[model samples]
Target: MEQYKKDFIDFMVSSNALKFGSFTLKSGRQSPFFMNAGSYITGSQLEQLGIYYAHAIHDNFGDDYDVLFGPAYKGIPLSVATSIAYSKLFNKEIKYSADRKEEKDHGADKGSLLGYSIKDGDRVVIIEDVTTSGKSIEETYPKIKAQETTPGGIKIVGEIVSLNRMEKSADSDKSALDSITEKYGFPARAIVSMKDVIEYLYKPDGSGLITNDIKKQMDDYYAQWGAIM
Candidate 1:
């Protein structure tokens, strides 16, 4: 695994974003482990979270995008933090935009968007915490760009998430990222994946320690769902 990826795995464990055993996901699958981005609550954690995302996006998508569009709710902070980090890291202003789940009809800065508005001739990247299914994208992608009939016309350049579970989407045999890539030409990437998680943690816990049982559970779960990769 890349050193940044390894660091991300450790960060997950340290932040309690990643946990082991019997997680009943929203998809109703019995997952051996789970990730909850909400655990990154502290100022320092959020700061570091942005740093990780900024680096990952730079590595995967480069510094060319005009905007970072994070979806509503959880994505709001993600966009803000990453925009800050991107500006600092790459020495450029990367505008951030987000949708309102409940659009407010009033205000000078009204309508479904916040931060910079999506405009013509703009390139964008969607940022998110994780994608177990492509459901969120299904809901938000159209709102980002709709004037054109073809999805390729959307200015979205790529997507970056914290983790890729590497499991099938809720409805399909293909992984969510794979399906999204097929449906839309843009790339979907992660800072680390379940494979990286296993490789980093299988030998030892985040503290360079091991509890072999958890590793076995991880292995077994992947053995069943990991064949797609």
Candidate 2:
């Protein structure tokens, strides 16, 4: 793993964002591990989170993209913070945009989007905390595609999430990220995978966050719901 990924794993654990044990996901799966991006609450934590995201985005997508389109709610802050970090770290001023659940009826900035308005010919990269079922992308992808005033519309170069669960979706044998890629025709990637987490935290000497019992539980969980990827 890269140093940033290793650092991100440490950061997630230190921030209590990534937890191991019994947890029920929104999809109703009994998961051995869970990651909650909302745990990074402080200003410093968010700044660091943005930096990590910037690194992953730059690594995966490079500096070709013009805008970062984060979906509503959770993605709003993600887009904003990472744009700032990208500007600071790479010296590139990337615009950030996000959709609103309810469109504003009567304002200069009315309609669905906030921050930099996604325009025609703008190359966009979707940023999210994590995608478990690939449902949020379904909700926001059309909203983005609709923003194109020109013929070709906007180009979605790729998507970047914090982690890849590496588990199959409820409806498919492929992982959620994989499903998104196949459906949207853009690459969906993560800073780290569950495999990376295991390799990093589980050691032969029995140290690290993942213990023998926890590893066994994770193994069973994967056996039941692991993705084809």
* The candidate that achieves the highest TM-score relative to the unseen native structure: 2
lDDT of 2: 0.92
As a whole number from 0 to 100, the lDDT of residue 97 in candidate 1 is 92
| Model 1 accuracy (lDDT, Cα) | 0.84
Instruction: Give a tens-digit lDDT track for model 2, residues 4-111.
Output: 999999999999999998999998999999999999899999999999999999999899999999898889888999999999999999999999888888879998
lDDT of each: 0.84, 0.92
What pairs collide in candidate 2?
none
Query: Looking at candidate 1, what is the lDDT of residue 63?
Result: 82
Q: Tens-digit lDDT track for model 1 on 1-229? A: 6687788888999999998878998877788888999999999999899989999999998987988999988998999999999889889899999998877689887878988878777899999999998899998788898633555564889988899999887677778888788787889889998877776666554353325777777677766665276
For each candidate in turn, the TM-score is: 0.92, 0.98
Q: Ten consecutive residues with minimal summed lDDT in candidate 2?
A: 203-212
